[model samples]
Target: MDFRFGDEDETFRAQARAWLADRLADDPAPDPRAWERALGRAGWIGLGWPGTDGRGYGNRCATLAQQVVWAEEYARCAAPARLGHIGENLLAPTLIAYGTEEQRRRFLPPVARGEELWCQGYSEPDAGSDLAGVRTAAVADGTGGYAVTGQKIWTSLARDADWCFVLARTEPGSTRHRGLSFLLVAMDQPGRIEVRPIRQMTGTSEFNEVFLDGARAAEVVGGEGNGWAVAMGLLALERGVSTLAQQIGFAAELEKVVSAAVASGAVGDPVVRAGLVRQWAELTTMRRHALRTLGATGDPGAPSVAKLLWGGWHRRLGELAVQVAGAAGAVGPGPWSPERPYELDEAQRLFLFSRADTIYGGSDEIQRNIIAERVLGLPREPG
Candidate 1:
């Protein structure tokens, strides 16, 4: 497949770059929410949604190449991380695909305008990679709605999310993958939902443990008892053009590792130098593979392959970072006051955070199983 961007795509890329530059020119340090709103106002948020919905920026009209160009440009500009990424990238696409007209009208606008944020509630304490093993219960109320009651762990951005799209077993005796429903639950409701932040080794709370105690969800996407399919579809969307953008970020991190090695005299070590060279080559090859697979249909093994590639690559890069830093990486930032304990420098933070790259989202073992069973026609693993 040709990877060249056509004239129109190039023009769109120029326009996107200029807009981002102008938006960031003055503040140099604008608030993330404000930047997101600017993107929303500039009609850059819902690139793949339909224009008639008034939420999309006519991005659906653009070719896949244009989308890739925009994503690469966004990462290249070093803009603020998007606060609405979950809504725009994962939930919105899922809704557009399986949601009813009412559901679309209700949820897509706030997301398109960057006024709302969403978190996923698919993983449980026992159900990380085995998503079909979700046991969060969502029983039907006497009314048309359902009352959700369960706990979800490793929920990213739960503390800041305005809503959560949850996968819960809706039927009483439901087994794995059956009788499940995707329910949209509001996070701001009083007394029903609770979010406890999970402080990572990096000393940040991006992930959380969320508890739902009779929380209400009147909006169920893709009908009841069909959440497994909808959830799988959303997982597939997770490996879109965003992966290319992520590779750009990986390139930046790799550069930092190289720079640290050079500054700390680690580059003079032949083994360290060889490892850095190998990392650079692998990153380049990963980017090429991503570009090659950009517009392919949803192959069952594709997302798993992409996840396995980047997860392991990033974890290794983190290790290389510490090796480059040598003894300095062993120390914490400053003397570690009581008020600010566990503070870490850039290399330290990368080393700690990237350790989870292979575990979160999906594990390496799970990805291998997906490739074997789905792509290679191997027998399913005995449960």
Candidate 2:
């Protein structure tokens, strides 16, 4: 596959780079939620929309690759990756494809412009990987919308989100994965939603446990009983393309750490140098696989490989970064120390956090099961 960007592509990249540099200087970087909206207003929120009516960004393979490049460049520039869940990846695409005209007009612009921040309400406390088991009920209110009641766990940025794409059971007697519906709910409503922070050991509350009590929602996506399909579509977006972008960007960060380690003379030993070199090679291979899978097809099952590979390599990279950082990495600021300059202590935090990489987005074991059953043509295990 020809990965080289053409002259026009190169020109677009140059323009994007310059535009980002200028806008970033004046923009105040906030938490992930606020940064997304700021990006929306600055015309950087939706890199794939390809029309004047909130779709003019050319949503194609080339556009996807360009997005990868932009993601890498953003990380390289140390910019907080803006364009959070709803606007860029999950909801936007789903809405574009399945939403009605009213739904499209209502959601697309805000999402594209980053005026609205969003989160996913899929996994309940009991329904983690088995998303089809969503117990959140959405009974019709007779006046068009539905009243939702349920709890969702592991909601990323739920506390700060203005909107949420929720999966709820609309028909009580229907089997799991059937009779469910996709609804877009406003989080600002009273008595409908509550967000309890699940603080990580890193002392950051990036994910939250969201409780939905009689939350009012509109059927914003695929028709009733088609929620499972819509959810699957959303999962594909999350796992395949978005995961690759995230992993590639992360690899870039790891490279920066490696560079710092080598420059600081921390890799004087042959073993350490060899380990670093091996990791670099592994990262290179990982990037290739990630990009390929991202561009191959929008298949939800394919992302498990990228997620597993990324989780493994990221954990290793984090471990190596902390190992090379040594005492400097473990400790807080000392005047002008290496750790102090770039907040190297964050490396330790990242190392600790990376431990959960395999657990999130679908565990390594789950990914392996998919590979064996789907890719390897293996027999299913006895239930």
Candidate 3:
């Protein structure tokens, strides 16, 4: 496949780069919430979403390549990591595919305007890799709404999100993937919803453990009992154009590792140089894979392959980062304290966080199973 960008794509890149540069200057806002609204106002929030109904949901519709361009330029600009990405990339696409027209009108505009944020409620303590094993239950309340109850672990941005898209077993006794429903619930349900941040070794709580006790879910997408399909579709979107942007960010991180190697004179070692070279080459391969598979919906294994590649590559990059940093990389910046226990530098943070890169978004084991069973037509491993 020709990975070259067309004229239209390059034009998009220029526009995105200029806008990102302008907004990211002066370190616009300390918190990303304000920046999200800024992106919405600038019409950069939902580039990949389809045009609205005549009532105007208010998002730009771009070609697949153009969406990739916007993401690339956003990363290249090093703009503050988007807080609205969960809504823009994952929920928006899922709603377009499965949500009702009324749901679209009500939800899409706020997301387009970046006024509300969303968190995914798929993974639980036992359902992290095996999502079909989720035990979260959403019982009907006789008002067309449901009361969601269960815990979701590793929910990124749960504390800040105004909403959560939860997958729960709508039918009691439903096991594995059956009888599930995808429900959208408000986050501010007093006494019903609680978000506890999971402090990682990085001394950060980007991921949280969310508890739902009789939380109200007003909207169900793809109808009740059809959540598995909807959730799978959303996961596909997770690994699609968004992965391209992630690769761009990875490129930036890789550059930092390379620069650290040079500064520490670790680039002179043949093994370190070989590792760096390997990372660069693999990144290129991943880029080409992304370009070639942009809209290839026929291949079920594409997303799994993508998850495997980036997850492992990021973890390895973290290892290379610490290695290139020499012995000094292992230490914290200042003396440990109760408030700032993990006062680590950039390399240590990367190393700690990257450990979960392979675990969070479907582990290496799951991806290989998908490839073997779905793509290669191999028999399923005996349970």
The candidate that wins on TM-score is 3
Considering summed lDDT, which 10 consecutive residues are worst modelled in model 1?
Answer: 51-60
Q: Model 2 — which ten-residue stretch has the worst lDDT?
A: 52-61
Best by lDDT: 3
> Which scores higher on lDDT, 1 or 3?
3
Per-residue lDDT tens digits of candidate 2, residues 15-42? 7678668767886465665676556666
Off by over 4 Å in 1: 51-61
TM-score of each: 0.96, 0.86, 0.96
* All candidates in order of lDDT, best leading: 3, 1, 2
Q: What is the lDDT of residue 135 in candidate 3?
A: 96
| Pairwise TM-score winner, candidates 2 and 3 | 3
Determine the C-alpha RMSD for candidate 2 after optimal superposition of all C-alphas: 4.3
Each prediction's Cα lDDT score? 0.87, 0.74, 0.89
Q: Which tens-of-lDDT digit does each residue in 12-46 have in candidate 3?
A: 88888888777667685547888888888988878
lDDT of 1 by residue, 1-383 (tens): 56887788889999989987987788767887777777777777777676445545323455678778878899988888878889989999899889987788888877877788999999999999888889899988988899999999999888878999999999999899899999999999899999999987787888899999999997899999999999999998899899999999999999989998998899999999999999999999888888887778868998899999999999899899989989878988677778778678888888889998898888999999989999999999997
TM-score of 1: 0.96
Error of 3 at 136 (Å): 1.1
- Report the Cα lDDT for candidate 2: 0.74
